[model samples]
Target: MNLEARKIEFVQEFLKLQNEEAVSRLEKILRKEKNASNERIFEPMTQEELNKRIDKSESDFRNNRFKSSSELLAKYE
Candidate 1:
């Protein structure tokens, strides 16, 4: 069936659920998923933008401007 029809069917079945604990668990899962989706911040970058980033990173590496993993970890820690 279509999306709306599927949603209605799900709601009907969900309403038939009699276990409060099960419903509460499902509600928590759905809320967590919704919150996780809302927390996303990054958008997809264009190929040109990606290329510019790669070029900049390569230049920095060649100039010894980049930090090693251990250095970064130590600094952050």
Candidate 2:
């Protein structure tokens, strides 16, 4: 009923699990869900913040201080 009780129940049931494939699938699903939840922890930027970032980026471009996409990708490849 409570969170701890539910976790205990889940652990008990998980301990009884016998299927390797099912456990692997469950592990992948849990990991993917955890990653997705973590990615939502950041709040979206406000309009003013967005505009400031855009202006800074334009300034950097005008100053020739930024890398091109092809140049960036070349390093990884």
Candidate 3:
């Protein structure tokens, strides 16, 4: 009924698929889930975006930006 249960059911159904076409479909479904999970775990962060963000933060610190490290830590945490 829930997400985890659905995932397990998907795997069970995938494993049970006997026909070549059915197995291919199941493989596609599994691949899609795998890609989605991987994307969520390791999101694309371009070098430029990372560099700009770091530069902005370093400048912010030099300029004595708001409050404290706790604020920054909250963003990263």
Question: Whose TM-score is higher: candidate 1's or candidate 2's?
Answer: 2
- Name the TM-score of candidate 3: 0.39
lDDT of each: 0.94, 0.95, 0.87
Q: Quote the lDDT for 12 in model 3.
A: 89
- TM-score on alpha carbons, each prediction: 0.48, 0.70, 0.39
Candidate structures ordered by lDDT, highest first: 2, 1, 3
Clashing pairs in 2: none
| Count of steric clashes across candidates, in order | 0, 0, 0
Model 2 root-mean-square deviation: 2.3
lDDT of 3 by residue, 26-68 (tens): 6798899999998889877899999999999999989988568
Better lDDT candidate (1, 2)? 2
Residue pairs in candidate 1 whose N, alpha carbon or C atoms collide under 3 angstroms: none
The runs of at least 3 residues in candidate 2 whose Cα sits more than 4 Å from the true structure, single-residue gaps closed, are: 2-4
lDDT of 3: 0.87
> Deviation in angstroms for 65 in model 3?
35
